[model samples]
Target: MPTTPRPVKTVLASVTAAVLLAAAAATPAHAQSPPLRDLADQQGLRMGAAVASHLLDDADYRRTAATEFNSVTHENDLKWESVQPQPGQYSWSGADRLVEFAEQNGQQIHGHTLVWHSQLPSWVENGSFTPAELTQVMEDHIDTTMGRYRGQIQTWDVVNEPIGDDAQFRNSVFHRVLGEDFIAQSLHMARAADPEATLFINDYNIDGINAKSDAYYELAQDLLAQGAPLDGIGLQGHLISGQLPQDIQQNIQRFADLGLEVMITELDIRMTMPVTQQKLEQQARDYTQVMDACLAVSGCSGVTVWGVTDAHSWVPDHFTGEGAALPIDDDYEAKPAYWSIHEALGGDGQNGPDDPGPGEPGTGTCEVAYDFTSQWGQGAVVEVTVHNGSGSAVQDWSLTWERPSGEQISSAWNSLIQQSGTTVTAGPVEWNRSIAPGGQVSFGFQTTHAGAPSVPGGFSLGSESCTIR
Candidate 1:
């Protein structure tokens, strides 16, 4: 959430400047140059932005959202904390304003979230309730919230961030009490409330092929197999500049292959502070890559940037030394990234390679590359790389190898690791969790050894024996 609040005067000034700029851009010569919404509509894409309800009071802010986007998501107004701060007491003033604005503008509403571990009122988090009681409470909230909007909101993020960065179900209250069944139950309740609405499981860090995404892939399949009303998967594409995932298109295609709609929800690319021309250019490229990936996939419905402008971006407050995330700057000027997306949407959508479609399940074939980067009298550093040739993405990958009898790992990075006796198990962290087909991720560890350390054997990726290199 954005912590710093802007004064009404400053916000008005920025909005005024934006309106003037928009007027200038709409001259007769530039009339053919459509706003993002017009371009997106041509390609059957919905260009959207997460909007602040209060900002809509300003004519320019409202105009910007109405003209540039065909979809609107309330940045915080629709969250659990915002709508239902007190148990059984609902507040809809903020959300209602946004909904009305969207309606007047002919825009689709994407319901932010019905259930999330964050922004939850203290009562819900601290209340001592049994599994059955908690389940009822959650279902009631879903019913009330969704039933209110019903067909107005086109899509709903029924479950948010159920999977943690460790590539496992988060130990949220719902999970701790009701277990994984909570997800299925929530989806079922949402479905019953509004049969016409599309329900999605939304999470961050699953934008590309990785362990976290693999978990979602498997979960989507399981839910469908059991006849759960799971309509889509929302990949919160909150990214960092210069680090766009290489296989993002493949990841989206894989999810689409499961016969589910995929959306790049909450998209933003933040960079380190003191923005430069070079950094902005890279940001444009990153935005282009994400939009291109979505365009290339038929099932990828749209791309929604997290916020309307850098003035209210959550990046600076949450991430130290990071800001300038959105396509619009603090002064309400469109940045290069905004134009990049506009151009991509208006031009041919063939920016990506011909889709090879989804890959088949691999034979669990893998390779492990181990090397001693440095060695000392009693301590040594080793770097290990795990390659995935499984043809399909591997979920929750675990690497195991035997270390010398007395050699023990003291410190490790880039992985969750533990040693039991002579065997060491390493699993992917949030960033390096998923290894794309024919791709690899590397992690290093420092260890203390007894005498001269000898190369350890019995290396394996999951149950498949890896050919050591």
Candidate 2:
């Protein structure tokens, strides 16, 4: 769901298995190269592809998918709308087709999603069911679909894109009726249906540690604390040219520290169309960077690209002027990005999982500088610059400091603020969640008190105490 511009309109067509293997004979560029799956297996990774049922029919596409990938995620066939279009009624023909292909090809089936805000059926969206009724509807869908595919699939994106960039829960129909608990409830239901399937909360813009990711981090912690059935975090590595977030490894590490698995679930780097060789090379580097980050973190389950070829890439329609996102182009030619990833996975029979792999940036301290932007009478606007004094990157941050006596935060911007006595905690909003090495983001708030502006004392970012100014 790499920031979809519009909804996917149709379920892909079905393809025969014979066509799948035949594509290998066509031998697109890099046909001489070793399969990506073999290289990934050496490193204990599940190299994956997001597949539409129809793509399996194209000889080259099918050959590449079945040969190069060890895992397959249904691009759209497994979603709620595609599976259950009406109340209590279900359809699995499309999803079954993909599952059968994965099994036939000896690939692990990674279920795309069980619940998502978009791609939901009309009944679920327009049926103004009460909160209790909607809860049943959601649980029923989970039981029906997940029950059908129980042990067949390895993972399920139980909840997807639940948190928006604003660092707040998205206003999906589920949220409208069931509130935040909807998330935990969905996970619980999914777990009940498929006890063996790994359950994940997946999102885009979370490939790096940032505000939106921070929100998920917080939610994941809460869910775990409550003993809710959450398993992994899916980093939808939907990247753009020259804009890879710098803290990918750190982000993955922190999530791993939480004892949850992580996966680069849907990765693609889109650039402006009519592409150049330089851009493709850059894209290759970006793809390698992502795979490298996955390798650095122990709990990272694997990496899965969004699609097999650019011809069917969603970029052209979703992102105007942007295409050529996949490693393979429309004509089944492997781009530089393909070889870059191949090299990262140890290239044609080179290194194994024991290798230290590539290096990653180090972490350091975070510091904050505060100032009163404007003051008049009892009201003053205060801004604090949270600097990533750390040599590495700082992901979704929490800034806490002690306010002067009787001072109260009236309102805030660029952060989520909470006050308990003189201690104030301001976490990032969506925009300012991450700070690259030496980079900084500032959040401001209006305060009311009897005296002129006064500085807060003893700021801290997460557990790291900051030098306050």
Candidate 3:
């Protein structure tokens, strides 16, 4: 059942987007400047893609992935064959390559899962596991795998797709033998292993609002109150065309209300076979709606698309009849959907209000965003986005920002940058310094904001100040 109006209806909605943003800027002239933006306006959402084992070995594929995403999720990184292929002889070949590849490129990594009934080994399935045997096996698996990547990986989808659409816990081996306590123990064991990596209970139906998700919410709340070591919730938003839920933003926010960071992980909007312009437009709108929901929620940390390019997307393989779930098409070219994402991210192209041309300095030609639910009130997070643009390798760089009075700088993350009063500084920070003719680099700043008002400045590798409103 489709909830939103058809494409013809949203075209008008697009018109209002540019106008509203224009009015917000201080200058009446700029405000009335017919709506302008580019791929720069979005906040700190880690746009990403899924990678297959076959593609991981290609130099070209790896390079493209580095450019397109900040984070990468391996589809079968922890499947039974890769994790515990033999009864007791676990192999880390595939997962190792993924972790190594991600690290070398300075990208974030997410361990796909520790437990999923679908991909487990047959031994773990019907192979004689008494209650004690299962519990030990579970603990050993969690401690071994999670502990291996303790400080490096960002998060883990601890337990995936455990609940049915009907809201009852799915009756799997873990449940039949270990029962509901299985969920709690799994998370607890995971926390005990890494303690640093964020642990999430992930699933698909919990993405949009509905009876199915309502059940997810209630269950999650109970888990939290009982002191389950849960730090995040993952909404695997596998949305399809003509079927986006309208109250998605509110739904994401509701989960954040439970005092945990929420992420749009494993997000890939699917569609029926034989795609079309009208269908593509609808897909863009769906992406916009999801990104907008993430932008509005405070505790919402970021959003990660399931795959970066359609050539490597899993939609075609997994779904009965769906393709074009990614923003980039098979050839790694940008699609209408890509522009739509940029638009939702405050881009200036057709997908946005006013798109910028190539190599525009300080215009955020290359950048990263942090869409934290709350602002840096009296505290601000300063982020530096560095780009090689085209034909440059940045071995070294520098940044200096002029701040307003009465604003004290607080703590910072990714300490590659340095700060100075009214004028904060970063860089001369080390890098391979070669952007490979057109490569890019970026880092973030978390500072306290003040009423005095300020817009960030001091960029290098080619730009100066960003267009601050």
**What tens digits encode model 1's per-residue C-alpha lDDT throughout 280-370?**
9999999999999999999999999888778778888788899899887876667788778877886332212121111222333687767
How many clashes does the backbone of model 2 have? 2
lDDT, candidates in the order shown: 0.77, 0.77, 0.62
C-alpha RMSD of candidate 2? 24.1
> Candidate 2 regions off by >4 Å?
2-22, 28-32, 348-469
Q: Which residue pairs in model 2 clash with each other?
A: 23-59, 211-433
Cα TM-score of candidate 2: 0.71
Q: Residue-wise lDDT of candidate 2 within 440-462, one digit each (tens)?
A: 66555557787776787678888
The list of candidate 3 runs beyond 4 A from truth reads 1-42, 350-469
**Rank by lDDT (best first):** 1, 2, 3
Compose the digit string of candidate 3's lDDT tens values, residues 125-172: 776788899999989888888888888887998987778888888888
- Which parts of model 1 have CA positions greater than 4 angstroms off? 1-32, 347-469
Candidate 1: count the clashes.
Answer: 3
